[model samples]
Target: MSFLAPIPLPAPLTTRALNALRRDIVTTRLAPGETLSEATTAERLNLGKAPIRAALAQLAAEGLVQPVPRRGWIVSLVTVRDIHEVFDLRLLLEPEAARRAAASAQDRAAAAAPERLDAVCRAGYRPEDPASALGFLEANRAFHVAVAELSGNARLARQIGRLLDESTRMLVLGLRRRDRSGEMAHEHRALTAALAAGDAAGAAALMREQVAASRAMVLAALTVPDAATVA
Candidate 1:
């Protein structure tokens, strides 16, 4: 009797697994403090248990997932304190990064950031559509991260990226409650103009304002009753 050969497994799924979990967390689909089962996740994503475990480990390093004593991993909750801490760090880093980026605007790579930011601003935010909101959030993160990268400091870009990642869920929550995407787009537009003009001080000031506004909106949203389930 002839037997069929077993199907070969796909290439490493760690990146795909990580991205799926990350998107779920940020979108609040998994909800904060929810327990995660590797086997269940593996089945849900149609991935192997090894990749799910690996993804969880990666997320733990990023502060999005925490291992419990006996239970499986739990999604980390974003506290008011966490919001303040993240914004405080952003206030310290992003303004300086923007200033440096503006100074380095003459560089070909750095000069391209303004165009990217313009594209994001043009995309705007869509409150009526959930998918559009997620798209806008991704674009928003890309724009900020791009500005940091334009500073020509790899370490600084990485730091800003981490801060942005941590703050994403809260930003999404705030966006769902409030429609400030237009104002956000306007701010981004002005910031891009400043960066393109090589105005270091202006760019720094604009970055500070953007971070401050985001902090205010997020914190305000979190204070409302039952806001955690708002999304």
Candidate 2:
């Protein structure tokens, strides 16, 4: 007879709890501003209260959750102002990053940037399938971050990754409000071609246009009276 392996401790348990909560929030399953009840979360996730609390604290630090004075934790709400701020930061960095990535992609003969982006564009999204919304968001985020990484700038890539995380939530909400997946995939294909061809200026311009359009869509969605219900 063999002895049973020891169960993992709270640190690892908290990490698993954190990832579950984060996925729910990012995928809109938790919904913006939904109160997080510890008991309910623990019961639903089959986790202990200790790990849930630890996960909430970490999520709050990431701006994905907010702690109320006397109530409990709530999923952070995205506002029009938040959209503007996030896109403003992206606009400042992404265009330049794309230009650099174009040059880098040209020098690396075996670069997979074009192929990776193409795969995402080809996969596209199905408006009728609700699950496709998350797939679209993940693909979109991967394409952007991959472009940034191809720039050969670690700091720039890290910054873009963080911005993309915040942008994913807005994009998911926008997709629910309006089906722009086809248009977005088309734009990604064009941008990928420009990068592969080393057209730095064209790539930069395309990236700017893409970010601006996404920002406009999200802002417009937030302005609707039933925006909350739509998502």
* Best of the candidates, TM-score: 2
TM-score of 1: 0.88
lDDT of 2 by residue, 1-231 (tens): 346878656598899999899889988899997998898999999999999999999899889999987688889988777888899999999999999999776577567769987886666678889898898888898889988888889899999998998889888989887888888988999999999899999999999999999998888777788665333
42-125 per-residue lDDT for model 1 (tens digits): 999999998898899989988899999778899988788888999999999999999999998886554467778798666656
lDDT of 2 at 117: 77
Give stretches of model 1 more than 4 Å off.
1-11, 107-112, 229-231
Model 1 / residue 158 / CA error / Å = 1.3
Write down the RMSD of all candidates, one decimal each: 7.3, 6.0
Q: Candidate 2, which segments miss by more than 4 Å at Cα?
A: 1-10, 229-231
